[model samples]
Target: MFCTCLCLVLAVSGGVATTTAPSLADKHNALGFRVFAHLASADRNLVFSPHGLSAVLSMAQLGAAGTTDEAMKRVMGFSLRERGASRQHRRMRRQLRAEEALRTAGAVAVERTMSVEKAYRRALSRAFGSHPLQVDFGRPERAAEVLNAWVADHTAGAVPELLAPGSLSDETRLVLLDALHFRGLWKVPFDPRLTHRGLFRGANGSATPVAMMTLTGRFNYGEFSTAGGEDYDVVELPYRGDTLSMFLASPFEADTPLSALAADLSGRGTPEWTSRLGSVRRQLSVPRFAVDSELRLKTALTDAGLANIFNVATADFSRIAAHERLCVSDVLQTVKFEVDERGTEGAAATAAITYSRMAVEELTLDGPFLFFVQHKPTGAILFMGQFNHPT
Candidate 1:
């Protein structure tokens, strides 16, 4: 497969187009960082799919009105209230699915006895590409089994069970889920013969030996700094088909925290600097690693300015099931990711900008760093994470 892209964004404000406001893609990416910033604990290897999670939330927003809809619009940046917003979302989804190596899925499971509004179901099917699955949530185990099976099928078993035992109960009026799986061969694969053991510096400054992958090639490299003036470096590694790429970044100074860079990147979209990257040949040493994490995002979302949906009284699902009482119980996202000599395989999270290094740049990630998996065509951050502790 051959992949190629560098997407751009047209900013908008209120109901008018503006050059100063954050674009739709930028807002979503920013939300990813805001959520990750909240979920981030002390030096934990965390990964979650911001793209997937947003899809589920957007689905929920379709059924909202009044204050509920307004909040979702403000927090997420785009809404059904905006002209052509749904069409834009659908177009973005189609562009992402065009690449065969990436798999994505979304679903809304409703209680077997309650009826879902046709308009809301149609909205999910049209905009998010998800169909409502009617299941008996009263039997929690059976409901979980059914939902998990569908998720496993979509993820190719990488995530067999997204919801563990007792995650659901008889009161589960609705369930929203998203599954993303991607396996991409590197455009320039790292040779295992050159791979060797090296010491990795943990977040706490402790060192441990890990398998390190080394590659010296010309890549889209850039040196940048946070608003607070902390320096960092970024390297772009494309998958076989240029459709997707992994952009890895880390602070240049050992004392500088990774969180600073993450926060800056969240404020800037990929296009802001991707076009400015200079092709440079650098000797790169990065740890081959994998991480699996389950993120409880209810508190994070509540903190991010969209809390009404989680509260039954304040929430509005009138567009979904007008006669029934429906409010979100919780939001959960599970992720599994891996990197090796051949390529990148992962599912799911975000968390900066520019300056440069002259001469032969030998960049090595021996400490905590952050990475982003981007859909180059749309400039959307599909997955992101902060690797404080190697797994």
Candidate 2:
């Protein structure tokens, strides 16, 4: 179940055209960074989809009124009041759907007892590209099964069980879910023969052996410093289509906390990092890792200054339904992301090579670092996380 409020926004904003608003992308980036900062805790493997969270929350903002709406806008960094903002969101959603490497799905499961307004349903249908589902939350067991099944089906079995049994109850008025499954092959696949177990320094001063995928190729690279004067490196690894790429950043000094880099990225948009990058030949060694994370966004959202939406009484959803007092009960997001030596079947022949004479600079993520799976054209961040320890 995706955020029902987000669904409402989608429905309301579906008609907005993409070309009409360029700031929409900026709004997406700002909101993505905000969510990342809130969800990213120091010293652990963290993974979540900023786009998924923001997309759903945008919907919620559309149906929100009074202070609830204000809180969402502040946290999300985008307001429905902006001219053509709704159209821009709708266009962005369509663009995401068109990407081959990314699979994103959102849904709102409303309790059968509640009466949904027809206008709300119409807007939801437009935003999600599907109609809302009615389920009997009175039977928590059955509700869990149904919602979990929907998540599994949408994510292509990557996330089998998103909502555990008894996660829902008779009192559950709404359930919002956003599931993202991404498997993108690199444009230049890492040589499998070069992969070997290497020691990864953990955040807490421990080291563990991990499978590291290595490749030497021309990549967009840059060197930047944090506000505190710490140096770091940024590298871009393009996926098969070039439309999606993973930007990896880590501090040069081993003892530097990954949090510093994360804070910088959140404060300064990714475009700054990308702008500093230019094509350079280097040897990159990233750990072969997979992270499946389940995030309850209530705390993160609240911390990001969107507190009133969760309040039972203070929250308002008058735009969605007239008489029923509706407030967001839970906003959940599940993300499954994996990085490996996989790319297009015959991409080896098309791989670009430059400057074989220079010694390849090694960019090994031997410790904690931040990574973002981003859409190149629009600069929308599909997923972002910290690889503190990849087991």
Question: TM-score of every model?
Answer: 0.89, 0.85
The Cα local distance difference test for each model comes to 0.71, 0.67
lDDT of 2 by residue, 1-391 (tens): 1111122111111111234443676677777677677777767777766666666676566667888887877777777545666566667767876877666667777777777677767666665554667878778788778876776677566456655665555656555555555557788889899999999988877899999889988999888788998888888998888998889898887788887888887676766677778898888898887665666677776787877776665777666665666666556655555677874211000000000011238878888888877888778886678888766
Q: Which pairs in model 1 have colliding backbones?
A: 3-241, 3-242, 3-243, 48-349, 49-348, 262-351, 264-352, 265-352, 349-383, 349-384
Give me the runs in candidate 1 sitting further than 4 Å from their true place. 1-23, 347-359
lDDT of 1: 0.71
Tell me the lDDT of model 2 at 26. 66
| RMSD (Å) of each candidate, 1 decimal | 8.0, 9.1
Q: In candidate 2, which residue ranges exceed 4 Å CA deviation?
A: 1-22, 343-360
The most accurate candidate by TM-score is 1
Q: Compared with the true structure, what per-residue lDDT tens digits does model 1 show for residues 1-391?
A: 1111100000011110236666566667877888888887657788777776676677677877888898888888778536777788888877777878866666677777877788988887778777777878779899878877876677676566666787666766667665556778998999999999998888877788999999998988888878898888788988888978988888876767777887777666667767657899888888998877766677898999877766766766678777665666557665668889998776432100000022356878888888888878888888788788665
